[model samples]
Target chain A: MRFYAVAVYGFLYLPIAIIALFSFSAGRSASSMDGFSTGWYVRALSNPFVMEALWTSLKVAFFSAVLATVSGTMAALALTGMKGRLRAIFDVLVMIAVMIPGVVIGIAALIALATAFSAINPWLEVVLGRQLSMGLGTLIGLHGMFTMSLVVLLVRGRLETFDRAQIEASNDLGASPLGTFLQVTLPQIAPAILAGFLLAFTFSFDDFIMAFFVAGSETTLPIYIFSSIRRGVTPEINAIGTMVMVASLTLLIIAQILLRTGTLRAKG
Target chain B: MAITQARARALLLTPAGLWYAALLLFPLAVVLIFSFGERNPIGGYAPGFTLEQYANLPARFAAFRNTLTLAPLGTVAALLIAYPLAYYLAIKVSVRWKTTLLILVIVPFWTSILIRSYAWIYLLGGNGIPALLEAFGLGELRLINTPFAVLVGIVYGYLPLMVFPIYVALEKLDKSLLEAASDLGAPPWRSFLQITLPMSMPGVMTGSMLVFILLTGEFLIPAILGGGKVFFVGNALVDLFLQSRNWAFGSAVAVALIVIMLIVVALYTRAVRRFGVRRDDVGLM
Candidate 1:
C-alpha cells in the first residue's frame, strides 16, 4: 500500500517537476537535460504580451473571486435558514451549475448575451446609449457565473458542520440578528469563505473554455497560452507555466494552512 | 423578531436569487430556445423555430461516439489507479505520512490541467519516452498522437479528482467493521472485498461519476495529446462555436450534451442508491 501511494504521488508530481526543471534548463527540448539557467524565465518576464496577459488574468480573478464569495455566502445563508423541498431544490440547482461543462456555459452565455442585445432593436440601445458586447466585463461576468456554484458548495459544506447553539445564545442575550451574525457567524466561517475565494480565484485564473467564448478581443493568460501553443511550443511557455504553477501552489498552500488552523481552533 | 427576521432572510436571498435567475437560468433558457431555432446563413442564431438542428444530430455522431467511449474508459482507468492509493492513504499509511501523501496527490491540481497536458505532450513525443525506449533497443515506438496517449493524459489529469473522494470515504469508514471481518477468519484480501469495498462503494461511485461527467465534455486533453485527430463532443462544440461560428448548431449540440449528461447522472445516482448506501455517503461534493 505504501508502495502504491508513493508511486501514485510520483506519477502526479513527476511531470510537473520536470516542467519546472526544464523551465530553467539551458536547452529547450524536453529530451535534453542541460545545465540550469533562468534565461527562459527572464525572457518570459520581459515579454510585453505575457505581462499583459498576466495582469489581465489577475484582474479577472480578483473581481471574480470577490463577486463569487459574496454571492455564495449569501446563498449559503439563505439556504441554511430554509427547509424541506425549497432547500433541496436550491441544492440541486447549485450542483447542476457546478456540474455543467465549462464549454456549454461559455457558449450559452455568449448566445444569450448576443441574442438579448440584438433583440432590443436599438430602442433599448438608444436608451442605454451604448452597445454591449464581450470583453473584460463579460469575462468577469462569465467567470463569476462559473465560480459561484463552487463557492456555494464549499461554504455550504462548512455551514453544515456549524454549531447553532451559539447563535441561539447570542440572540437570547439581547444581541440583534445582524450583530450576532457579524460578531459570531462570520468569524466562525471565515476560513471557509477564504477557501471558497482561493478556489474560485484559482479556477477563474486557470479557466480557458469560458474565457475563450466571452473574452472577445482581449486575451487572458490561458487564452494567450492556447494561442502560443497553437503557433508553436516555446521555452517561454514553460517559463510562464512555471510561474503560474508556483503562484497557484502558494495560494493553495496558504488556503490549506488557514483551513487547518481554523479547524484546530474551532475544536479548541 | 421572528417576522422581521423572516423578512430580512428573504431580503438577503434576493441578490443571489436574482443573480442566478439572470446569469444562469436565463442563459440556459436562451440556449434551449436557440437549440430549436435555425442557424442563420451568416453564422449566428436566427429566430425561426425549427428542429432541423436536432434532426441533423448525426453530423456529430463521431464526436458523441468518441466521448461516450472515452469518458467511461478514462473514469475506469482513473479509478483503477486511484483506489489502491486511496486505500493505502486511508487504511495502511500511518498518520504521520497521510497528510504529506494527500498533499502530493493534490499538488498537480494546483497547476492548470492545460499545462499538465502539455507536459504529457512533450514526454510522449518522439524525443522523450520513445527515445528512452529506443536506447534499450526496444525499437522505435510511436506513442504520441494516439488514442492511448489521450487516455494516459486523461488518467493523469483526473486521478487526483478521483483519489480525494475515495480517500475521504475510506478515512471516514468504521475500522471495527474491517476488524470484525478479519476476526471472523476472512483473509485481508477477502476482507477488503467484502467489508471495505462495499462500504466504500459510495465514494467509488461518486468519484467515477465525477470523472466520467467531466471526461464527457473533455476537449483540451484530446486537443493537446491527440493532436486534434481524435475529437470529442466538447471539441466539436468548441469548433462549432469558435471555428465555424454556428451558434444554432452549437446550441443544439450543447442541449444534446446536457440531456445526455442528465440521463447519465440520473442513471448513476439510481445505480449508486440501489447499492443500498445512504445519500450522503454516495454524493460527496
Candidate 2:
C-alpha cells in the first residue's frame, strides 16, 4: 500500500516537476535540459503577446472572482431562508451549472451570445453607434456565472456548520438584521467566501475551453499557451507553464491555510 | 419589517437568479431551439426549423463513439489508481502529515490542465520516454498523438478530482465499524470489503460522474495529445462552431452531449440513492 501510494504521488507530480525543471533550460528544445538559465523566463516575460494575454487573463480573473463571490454569497445567504420546492429547484440549477461540461457551456454560451448579439446589436447600433461583441466582458461573465455555483457550494457548506443561535441572540438584543449579519454572519462565512474567490480566480486564469469558444478576437494566457504549444513546445512555453504553476499553487496554498485556520478558529 | 425581510430575500436572489436565467437557462434553451434550426449556405444558423441536424448526427458519430469509450475508460483508470491512494491517505497516513500530503496531492491540480498536457507531450514524445526505452534496448516506439497518450493525459489531469472525493468519503468513514466487524471475527480484508467499499461508493460515484461528464466534453487533452486523431464530442463541437461555423449542427451536438450527461447524472443519482447516501454527501463542488 505504501509503495502504491508513493507511485501514485510520483505519477501525479513527475510531469509537473519535469516542466518546472526544464523551464530554466539554456537549450531551446523542451525535451532536453542543456544547462540552467533564466533566459526563457526573461524571454517569456518580455514577449508582448504573452504579456498581453497574461494581462487579459488577470483582468478577467479579478473581475470574475469579485462578481462570483458577491453574487454567489448573496444567493447562498438567500437560499438559507428558502425551503421546499423553490429551494429544491434552485439547488438543481446550481448543481446543473456545476455539472455541465466546460465545452457545453462554451458552445451554449456561444450560441446564446450570438443570438443575443444579433438581437441586441442593432438596437445598440441605433443608440450607441457601436456593437457589443465577445471579449473580456464575455469571458468575465461566463467565468463568473459558472464559478458562482462553486461559491454557493462553499458558502452553503460553511453555513451548514454555522451556529444560528448567534443570529437569534443578536436579534433578541435588538440588533438590526444588517448589523447582526455584518458582525456575525460575515465573519463566519468570510473564509469560505475568500476561498471561493481564490478558486474562482484560479479557474478563470487557467481556463481554456470556454475561453476558446467565446473569447472572440481576444486571447487568454491558456489560449496563448495552447496556440503556441500547437506550433511546438519550447522552453519559453515551459517557462510560462512553470510560472502559471507556481502562481496558482501559491494561491491554492494560501486558500488552504485560510480554510484550515478558519475551521480551527471556529472549533476553538 | 416582515415585508422588508421578504423584499431583502428577493433582492439577494435577483442577481444569481437573473444570472442563471440569462447565462445558464437561456443559453441551454438557445441550444435546444437552435438544434432544430437549419444551417445557412454561409454556415451559421438560419431561422428555419428542421430535423436535418439531428438526422445528420451520425456524421460525427466517430467523435461521439471515441468520447463515450475513452471517457469511461479514463474514469475507470483514474478510479483504479485513485482509490488506493485515497485509501492510504485517509486510512494509513498519520494525522501529523495528512494535511501536507493532501495538499501535495492537489498541487498539480491547481495548475492549468493545458500546461500539464503540454508537459505530457514532451514526456511521451520521441525524446522523453521513448528515448529512455531505446537506451534500455526497447527499440523505437510511438507514444505521442495516440489514444494511449490521451488516456495518460486524462488520468494525469483528473487524478486530484478523483482522489479528493474518495478521500473525503474515507475520511468521513467510521473506523469503529471496522473494529466492530473485526470483533465479530471478520478478517481485515473481509471487514474492508463489507464496510469500506460500500461506504465510499458515494465518493466513487461522485468522482466518476465528475470525470466522466467532463471527459465527454473534453477538447484539450485529445487536441494537445491526440493530435487530431482521437476526436471527442467536444472537439467536434469546437470544429463545428469555431472552424466550420456550423452553429446548428454544433448546437445539435451540444444538445446531444447535454442529454448524455443528464442521463449519466440521473443514473448516478439513482445509484447513490440505492446506497442510501444523502445527496449532500456527494459533493459536486
Candidate 3:
C-alpha cells in the first residue's frame, strides 16, 4: 500500500514535473533532456502575447474573485441565518450552477449573452452612442458567477460550525449589525472567505471552456495557451505552463493552510 | 422593525439569488428553448420551434458514441487506480506522513488541466513515451492521438477527484469493525470484502459520478491529448458553437448532454439511496 501510494503520487506529478524540468531545457522538445538552459523560460517571459494573456487572466481572476467572494459571503451569511424553502431553491441553484458541465455552461452563456447583447446593443448604440457586445466585462461577469459556488461552499463549510452565541453576544453588547459583522463575524470566517477568494481566483484564471465561449475577441491565458498548442507545442509553452502550475499550487497551499488554521482557531 | 429583519435577510440573499437566476437558470432556459429552435441561414439560432434540431442528433452520433464509451471507461479506469491509492492513504498511512502525502495528491489538481495535458503531449507524443517504448524493443507504437492516449490523460487528470472521496469514505470506516471481523476468524481479504468495500460504496459511487459527468463534457483532454483525431460530445459542442456557429444545433446537443447526465445522476442517486449510504457524499458530487 505504501509503495502504491508513492507510485500514485509519482503518477500525479509526472507530467507537471516533466513540464517544469523541460521548461529550462536547452533541448528543442521534451524527448531530449539535453543540458539545461533558461532560453525557453526567457522566451515565454518576454513573449508579448503571453504577457497580455497573463495580464488578462490576472485581471479577470482578480475581479471575479472579488465579486464571487463578496456576493458569496453575503449569501452564505444569509443562508446560515435563514430558514425555509427559499433556501432550498437557492441551494439547488448553486448545485445546478456547479453540476452543469462546462460545455453546457459555455453554450448557455453564449446564447444568453449573445441574445442579451443583440437585443440590447442596438438600444445601447441609440442611447449611449456606441455598440458593445461581448467583452472583458461580460467575461468577468460570467466567470464571477461561474465560480461563486465555490466561494459559497467554502464559506458555508465554516458557517456549519459557526458559533451563534458570538453574534448574540455582539448584539447584546449593543454593537450595530455592521459593527458586529466587521469585528465579530468577519474575523473568524475571514480565513474561509480568503480561501474562497483564492480558490475562485484560481478557478477563474484556469478556466478555458467558459471563457472560450464568452471571451469575444479578448484572449485569456488558457485560450492563448490553447491556440499556441493548436499551432504546435514548444518548450516556451512548457515554460509558461510551469509558471502557471507553480502559481496555482502556491495559491492552493496557502488556501489549505487557511482552511486548517481556520477550523482549529475558529473553534473558539 | 419586523419587516427590517426580513428585509435585511432578503438583502443579503438577493445578490446570490439574482445572480443564479440570471447566470445559471436563465442561460439553461435559453439552451432548453434554443434546442427546439432552427439554425438560421448563416448558422446561428433562428426563431422557429422545430424538432429538426433533435432530428439532426445522428449527425454527431460518432461523437456521442465516443463520449458514452470513454466517459464510463475513463471513470472506471480512474476508480481502479484511485481506489487502491485512496485505500492505502486512508488505512495504512501514519499521521506523520498523511498530511504531506494528501497535499501531494492535491497539488496537481490546482494546476490547469491544459498545462497538464500539454505535458502529456510531450510524454505521449512520438518523441516521448512511445519513442522510449520503441527503442526498448516494444515495437513501433502510435500512442499519441489515440483513444488510449486520451484515456491515459483522463485517468491522470481525474485521479485526485476519485481518490479524495474514497479516502474520505474509507477514513470514516470504523476500524474496530474490521478488527471485529478478523477476531472472529474471518481472513483479512474476506473482512475487506464484507466490511470495507461495502462501507466505501458511497465514496466509490460519488467519485465515479464526478468523473463520469466531467468526462462526458470533457473537451480539453481529448483535444489536447487526442490531437484533434478523437471526438467527444464536448468536441462536437465546440465545433457546433464555436466553429460551425450553429446555435440551435449546439443547444440541442447541450440539452442532450444534460438529459443524459440527469438520467445517470438520477439513477446514481437511487442506487446510493438503496444502499442506505446516501449522505453528504452526494453533496460533494
Question: Which candidate number has the best DockQ?
Answer: 2
Output the better candidate (2/3) by DockQ.
2
**Runs in model 2 lying further than 4 Å from the true structure:** B277-285
By TM-score: ranked, best first: 3, 2, 1
Per-candidate Cα lDDT values, in order, are: 0.85, 0.90, 0.88
Chain A TM-score for each of the predictions: 0.94, 0.98, 0.96
**Every candidate's CA RMSD:** 2.8, 3.0, 2.8
Which ranges in model 1 have alpha carbons more than 4 Å from their true place? A28-31, A84-86, B277-285
Report the lDDT tens digits of candidate 2 across residue range A11-125.
8888888999999899977788899999999999999999999999999999999999999999899888577676897899998889888888888998899889999999999
Error of 3 at B140 (Å): 1.3
How much does candidate 1 score in TM-score? 0.95
Superposition error at A234 for model 2 (Å): 0.8
In model 2, residue pairs whose N, Cα or C atoms come closer than 3 Å (at least 3 residues apart or on different chains), thus clashing, are none
Which pairs of residues clash in candidate 3, taking residues 3 or more apart in a chain or in different chains?
A: none
Weakest ten-residue segment in model 2 chain B by summed lDDT: B276-285
Q: Give me candidate 2's interface root-mean-square deviation.
A: 1.0
RMSD to the native, candidate 1? 2.8
Range of the 10 consecutive residues with the lowest summed lDDT in candidate 3 chain B: B276-285
Model 3, A163-192: lDDT tens digits are 989889999999999999899889999999
